[model samples]
Target: MNRRDFLKLSGLTAASLALTTLRPRALQSPTRKLNFVILLADTMTAANLSLYGYPRRTTPHLERLAGRAIVYHSHYSGGNYTTPGTASLLTGSLPWTHRAINLGGLVRRQLADRNIFHLLGSNYHRVGFAQNLWADLFLRQFRADLDTHIPSPTFIHGQEKPLVSQFFKNDELGAYYALDDFLLSTHHVVNPTAGSASMGYLGLFYGLSNRDIGTADAEHPYGLPSNGYYFFKNSVLYDGICDTILDLHRRENPFFAYFHLMAPHSTYRPTRQFVDTLVEMEFPTKQFHPLGGRTNRRTLLEQRKVYDEYVANVDAEMGRLFDSLDAAGVLEDTYFIITSDHGEFFERGEYGHDTPLLYNPVIHIPLLVFAPGQSQRVDVHTPTSSADVLPTLLSLAGKDVPNGEGRPLPGLGGSEDGARPIFSVEAKQVSSFIPLSRTSISMVKGTKKLIHYRGYEKYPDAFELYDLQTDDEEKRDLYAEDTVTAERMKEELFDHLADAEKTLKK
Candidate 1:
């Protein structure tokens, strides 16, 4: 068969497989076990949401849902990007412990079994899915513990090329590293490819085919939303999620489902209805960092507008999904949690989360928990980390909370600690196996935040301190003025770093 014929046949085969695999089994009476659903939105920062006091009304749906849910106001992610941020959430440990610090990296083999899936155990039906390839690696790592591992492209539309990860299910990680990352690498800007000449020719054809299939329809005016790997529609994804939840509701056992959706991350393409609908607003101008991307303020504001619109679009679909599930009585026995892996940045001359700066916009994420039969909203202003999620979930499941850096989240079987230290690490440039020789660590203790930069040529051993209570914008740097607070925080930060590095030796 010709190349065109081969591609077409592959597409048809994939569709057939999806239809057969996704069809629900014979329905059974629901059990008494509690259900848990974690809905993660990639690169969604609380700073951009009206739910978190942003001037723009970007999340009306989430705001309405918060009426009966528990909202966390001061939540931070473990790292600036997907690998480490997601690893922390899954393992209930910081990036320093899990060592998933690099792009497309996996958790340390020794700590492999210490994830949420294993903690939930066989009593509950564990399910995992992620649209972001980087976040999907964690699911691939713990596939053995999962009762249902959904394919990344199961809900994606207009897929022409066969995915290496889907075909080689048993060895998805290795296959992805070899074929998708090296030989048939189409995503080059974020991930490096081996640059095979023959594969490049084939990739060109694939791109053309994909473009033809992924043309903007009437529903999506700007374009179909993508995760840099494939194109998908927000409505289709949400509908699939609702269907999955309904299927779970009919099952005999309780379930722990993690759906990591790729929206409002990048390539912000909202629907026609959401585009240009947000009020134009100005953000506070901050000094550019030496390590920043140096993007102009006007461009940053413009990108923020588009990002806000995309967030609104995602929120609308989420509202639909929740309403459908509630109508189906799925919410009666489920604990629904909504959060993000990491957050986006649009200030200090940086347009995305790729920069080394560990500012609030790039690390502060939203956390909302909806308990069964919840009626009144509960707000927790105590600072929390993504690492806290795993332990909290276990506690809610009536399981023993494991020993880790994270304690159960406040208002959920854990007490609030106002002075608790929350740390976020950024070390994409450093090797995951080695001790972190060069990195940026931000320590948030109560309302004060101290950012320490180590082993960089431009700003070696630098420090920036901000009292978030007073300067939430982080306009004023209090490193020099607040000598007592600065020295105390600096010492605490370094001492913690020293302790984390010591684990590498053993």
Candidate 2:
């Protein structure tokens, strides 16, 4: 069946079914409040942005918007990985409580039935648009709370060529034809995994990397080629998502649109135009860290340049999205939030996320909230996790913030003095014998932070403490030296964990 036919067969066409199954009954209420637009960048580091004083012109649009929004300098994600961080953002609960640590996990089953989407659905229209495979995973969970969920186009038409065609030059076209036949007939293909099983399938076309059907060429297919930099300049994910936001702005109703951008992540490709701009800027290359080693200062500097350029590209696209919102006259009524699931580490031995080291580079993300009629900039020094996002957004919409582990943020007029202990958990995976096993749990109260390793056999685990008043980067380890401070922090952390367990049991 074609895409439309498949959607029809899936019972997605019935408005009543979609509304009843996808949304909460509270959304049917007559109150119309603030609309929400959450723009999430995958694997983005706040330190890379010019607005955050990265020494590069990375986020011109964001810098401009920061003047009119509240920029939280110390905002951290609840977890170090995508699924857990995103789960925390959506449910306002730590990963340990939400239990959505991996790719296939579902948030709806584990957490309380109260989500920002579910709470706002009672009064506003909820929609989502995601570009990355991980974002798609969250979208699947979000579908349970949204009034309308729009699946992003897997591939862009003019921007990206078929992956199969790019890899296999001579017979690439023919190969795609053969792969298409296999996909249509068998509904299952081994070479290039079909549907959403593989990352390649999540692109614009399903047959982008089918080797059996396409012709082989000199270029590498499985890995990114050296000349792969060209594709970043010409890629379509940014513009395509911008167009979606524009269309949603024109529709009637207070809407919640969650847009996820895949750029500035990995396979780090900044458009040639952006790269050229960086070159002209004459950024210091002495600090580039291509290999991600501690001593590769030159490589680190160069990688930062590349990361900044990619962020600039995203910023330009965001300018277009913001302009569209302003033109649609929804800018004032919208509660806009821009953040990331996690940050990337340039090869520093940390190529991607989920590192053993919980460094600030991986967890410290940019968080900016622009609520209607709120103009003053408020710096929230208190430690805030991604888990607080949902509750804060719900409260801003004049809805009762759901009862969850996350408390409403103080600066948004929802709560005051965010003094409660905040915790973050990371679960690498689960074993068959133990159902809900996790990797590590990190808790922060006041200035102290503790990380407990549960999945590993290591006893006493590990812990790190940072007095935010003095050390923000968390460079010095005070665990061993400051016994009294460490013990007090550990007690606070355990108390919060025990309380959460009791709440779950009840």
Candidate 3:
């Protein structure tokens, strides 16, 4: 039986009347105030994008847009995964301070009031939505500051699933994980959207309906392929985003629209044209460390090939979005920022971004700003953190950066704090309120970097150093080779951690 039919038999559906409403508020005069729109694409690593000099032509559309936008080459996510990375962007605080270190953790209650939405206040209509349930958690935490919150499922532009899911409110918790992957993952029949909890009985039906999509040799025949529980295609998601932007233009003047899209992530759903075009499909012959994860070279190459294709597909969708905004004349008055929550890794025996490793593939990301009235393109080679995004947006809106760890972007009335060590943390095993009891961290200053991995049962507490200017891939360990640099960076890393821990007491 299909998942929907199984759900009917199991009686797991709940009929709740409440539904999300995206109605426009009272129409007000367009007072020529600048609007801000953040296009947050989840799991889009910069290492794979052709815009960042990858061998594959993965991002031709973004290459076109980057000409007019301010692009940062060395931008890094605050955390290796969603919880910590998205929290850093919203809270303007690092993983240690915001403490979204756990898998599904939220920002600290004390610093919760200091988010971008709250800091922006009522001066503009603060709108927030994310297709990623993990990122949506942070938005829900900061919901008090939002003027309107469009639902994530609304991003699906075309026909939704069975009619029953529409009327009944789905169990959101069910969407968090799927039982289908237990047996069906290797065979692969159920698409990612099949896990959504919003459809109530329909969600359970999705759980029940893992159809026979043929063997692993045959890719998706009818349903979309999926790696995680979330099911959203970038093309449809981008269509909804374009529609959202134009709709907000019609709303009250000066709106802060934060649309976090789930695209270019896992399950690598690239269109036909983008698939298998690249020459190299085999994994690298790099020395095998046999560390944390189980992915081999062949698996890495397979995952990366599709991931690049999916990234290219998303880039094309972005091109359409830009065209729509330009046609509406909203681009002239809107501050558009394109970035990702975190990156994925294909190296170091890892397939996806679930590992605790903070390698360059997992942390390095793309950051671009198409500020209003920015006629000429600018590039910032200096290193920056995702934590700076909130303050940079604040600065663009003519507001102060607040007393947070982030500084504004260089082009937008901010300077590169290269002297101040930038930090990245991964603390999936620890609680949000407790800081630094068990965590993985990276400290970046100038060309030197130091990474600390602690509390992992597989990996002991250790410090690894790398010269980013020389080793961008972080394959070489410079800890023993460069003692002077390592010691200095270690001191800075611990000091920053100490400061972050002190915030907990306050």
Ten contiguous residues minimizing lDDT sum, candidate 1: 19-28
* lDDT per residue (tens digit) for residues 1-506 in model 1: 76644643454454333323211111122335678999999999999999999999999999999887778888999999999999999999999889999889999888899999999899999999999888888899998989998989878876644466668988988888777777777665754454576875687687777875666778787778877667888899999998998898799989999999999889898999998899988788889898888889999999999999999999999889889988888887788999998899898889889988999998999999887776656767778999999998898777899998889887676767878899999998889888888899999998899999988998898999999977898889999999999999999988888888887666
What C-alpha lDDT values do all the predictions have?
0.86, 0.60, 0.72
Cα RMSD (angstroms) for every candidate in the order listed:
11.9, 12.9, 12.8
Q: After superposition, how far is residue 83 of candidate 3 from its true place, in Å?
A: 0.6
- Model 2: runs farther than 4 Å from truth? 1-33, 108-112, 158-239, 276-302, 374-376, 416-418, 431-438, 454-460, 502-506
TM-scores for all candidates: the values are 0.92, 0.73, 0.83
Q: For every model in order, what is the number of clashing pairs?
A: 0, 26, 9
TM-score for candidate 2, residues paired by index: 0.73
Please give, for residues 1-506, the per-residue lDDT of candidate 2 as tens digits: 76534543343223223223212322334464457889898778876777776766788888887766666666788777777787788888876677666643556464536666777764567777655545555665555676665544333322232333223334432433344222322233223344333433454353354323323223313222111111322235555655665666667766787876666676565655566476434432323222224536455556666667777877887776666666666666667788998876644434456464455667778998765644444445556788888887776666787677777665563443345666666665663123334456666666566656654544335566766545555556687888897798788777776775665565
Error of 1 at 391 (Å): 0.5
Q: 291 in model 3: Cα distance from truth in Å?
A: 4.7
Predicted structure with the largest lDDT when compared to the true one? 1
TM-score of 3: 0.83
**Number of the candidate with higher lDDT, 1 or 2:** 1
Candidate with the greatest TM-score versus the true structure: 1
Cα deviation of 488 in candidate 2 (Å)? 1.1
The lowest-lDDT stretch of 10 consecutive residues in candidate 2 is 220-229
